[model samples]
Target: MKKTILSILIGLLVVCFAGIVSADGIETGIYYEVDVSFDDDVEPGDSFDVEVEVTNIYNQNGTYVDIEDINVEVVIKDIDDSGSDDLDDDDDIDDLEYNVDDSIDFEFEIPLAVDDQSYDIYVTVEGDDENNGTRYTETFNFTVNVEKKRHKLMMKEPVVNYETLKCSRTTEVSVTLWNIGTSDEDVEMTVYNTELDISEKSSFDLDAGDDEDDIKTRRSFVLDLADAAAKTYTFYVKAEYDDGDERETEPFTLKVEDCPTEEPEEEEVTIVEEPTTPVITTPAVVEEETFMDQYGAALLLGLAYLVVIIVGVVLVIRLKKR
Candidate 1:
């Protein structure tokens, strides 16, 4: 009976040792050492990289065991949110020989809405042993601190009442400014065109709030192109705030055209004339005489002489004939 009891105790001890070895993977010879590297001062709304180096360890028998189908994954856990991102190109290794080290890079972007605080980054390495096909998983994590900039300004696309303006005309230019930083700001907005020789400025205050209305402000300027020439003009809207922190919108174009000239209208005219009076002419008086009355006496005397001569000639001719 005493020998049987001792043998039973020994068997029980052996069983417990085997369970420990199996649980710790000492017998399977699939162990790994992990090293993670990253930046400590991570900012919100920024992307960072975490490099993991996984080294395979030999078994308890002092023999090298190959690991196959190795995969590395990474996740970020904040106070209120958690997310996982895909690893870089070299995220997995087909086979890792004994005592060899492999590395993978994981890129994570901090959400813009994330608070400025500490975040936990968890890295998991998983693989299978080639000889026994036993799967092994190891997890590691580290903390990252996030901070925000105190003076940051963002300018949205400017809205213009007229993209194409006529010369000697006025246009209304409006833009919205956002205070995305941590502190309130006194913003100075300017709308300028160098070629047009125009510069207009306005000032306002913005609160550092996450809401739309609290952190946003709109400003408008009346750009008078009265003296501007007719051509393509490049204009820029800039915001200056919070100790020389400046932000500018992308350059926008405005086409200024010559004002159209209207032609003069023709007018019809009517001419009025005064009535003319008739002119009276006087008649001239002249003495009137008959043609026969004036020459009657003279003609009678001449006729008498001619008759006497004719009578004499006739008598002479009659005597000669007898």
Candidate 2:
């Protein structure tokens, strides 16, 4: 047992040494060629898609061996700086393996978040060596722009008016959408209320227009309000076009007002060949009066006395006898 343990430890050291140390400085049967295709100019805060293909070009065990499976990771650096030889984060690389049945190709996805005017993306591919425990590393570089992070979702009627029992209420709102992608593409949009619980915002189809109206997408919502207050409800609009997607547009709030409800129906009774009594609605008394109303009413009362004086013959006779 001791001998077996000793043998395993020795083997581990040998493997670890073999992984990074080659007379040629880490030679492995696995090789990677990474190619990227993206929009030429990515605008600040724009979005673009990146596709990476890693081809294995080598042979193993006297047989022509191809990289069966490998995972590639991407790192973004300042345009002025080059990436480090060592990985920044351990999770930068994904674990991938090639099985006898699955030995064909290796693929992976990564996103580039553009925070600067321009940046460089470094891609690293790691794979297992069949003969030894050595790990083969391959790298590729690409340039990115802040414009690539530029993405927008436009809402025409951001604030929807909701109907209520009070007059002067409104709630239905509609909006138009656009791809805004550097390339012509379709995006999935999600809408949700931050304060109030609302139905999930659904996806809409948008395309970058070549002709008029080609870049526009139309969508609408009937925002509902149960209360009679003018409080604001915030909604979140986020879009994800495809793989390597991210979010934008911090949650924004929209003020909504209550809409008036429909008037009640009037029920009428019918009589055949006979006149029907009219439905009498009593006049509502005005309890609250403005200053002008009170002044006008006092003026009319004073005018009544003046009219009595003009027709004062009967009143004067009664007053003289008294």
Candidate 3:
């Protein structure tokens, strides 16, 4: 009779503890059920060292609980690995994938191949056992902070005559802008008088392929060689754009040399001589006498006398005859 009573009491105790264990998964020190925690801080390119501890509280009946499919995933936001500052304003980091080792004490350190930003850590557990049938698995989450550096442009090709690559006469040159940053970013470029400054001024976008085109167009400014000033004055193109949410690009240079000038040529002259002295010659002539002076007075007197004499003779003859 005593043995039967003892057996019943043991069964009752088992049932009570089972309820408590189910209510609050397994527990060990600060680790409650299935929870994953990282070790301090993590940076880009650095590995993630995390620890996970699980609790399994139950009587050793023929049926037992077994933890399966334990996935530990470390995730952050989206990144193209170039120049990017797109982050969740509210810290929205989701676990897109996971890693598992099927062990109670699990550790994960994945080589981070992404941009610099904070990430949220996630622990997922799939638990299945014999005695208590199947139990509810646990999931824990946390976040970590990270940061990436921006890109820098270095001008290796000097502002010398790109074709000849030297300063001889007035000439144009082609320059190259190098992407010295490990990461990628877009570069906007502008030009100013020798000294560089950022303004709306007419600059264009430059990609990795042709960084040269960044400062292709420049504003007009007089560069006087002054009598015999140095052949050329060097100007600069200041490239500015989003580099990891910031702006940069330093000392983009351009050289301006004076063209060779020639002195004015002398004017020529020609002359012709004029003739001297006037040449005059003699002209021949004929003379004549006046007609009236020759016979006018005598001829008129004789003509009057003759006419009177003839009239008188006629008158005498006619009287006699009658």
Looking at candidate 2, what is the lDDT of residue 269? 84
Which has the greatest TM-score? 1
Could you give candidate 1's per-residue lDDT for residues 164-185 as a string of tens digits? 9874478888887766677888
Q: For model 3, what is the C-alpha lDDT against the true structure?
A: 0.41
Under the 3 Å rule for N, CA and C atoms, how many clashes does model 2 have? 24
After superposing all C-alphas onto the true structure, candidate 1 shows an RMSD in angstroms of 18.5
For residues 1-322, write the lDDT of model 2, one tens digit per residue. 9999999988665443322321111222235444455554554323445555455554456554434235556554542112222213222333333322211222222222112344555556667665464676665555654443234434333433442323433355454554444455556556666456755465645544222265566665665545426676666655556542644333545565556568999999896787789999999997998887769888888899989887797788889999
- lDDT comparison, 1 vs 3, better candidate: 1
Candidate 3 wrongly placed segments (more than 4 Å): 1-32, 35-40, 57-115, 150-322
**Tens-digit lDDT track for model 3 on 279-304?**
77767665565675677778788889
Ranking by lDDT: 1, 2, 3
TM-score of each: 0.53, 0.32, 0.27
Q: Give the per-residue Cα lDDT of candidate 3 at 171.
A: 38
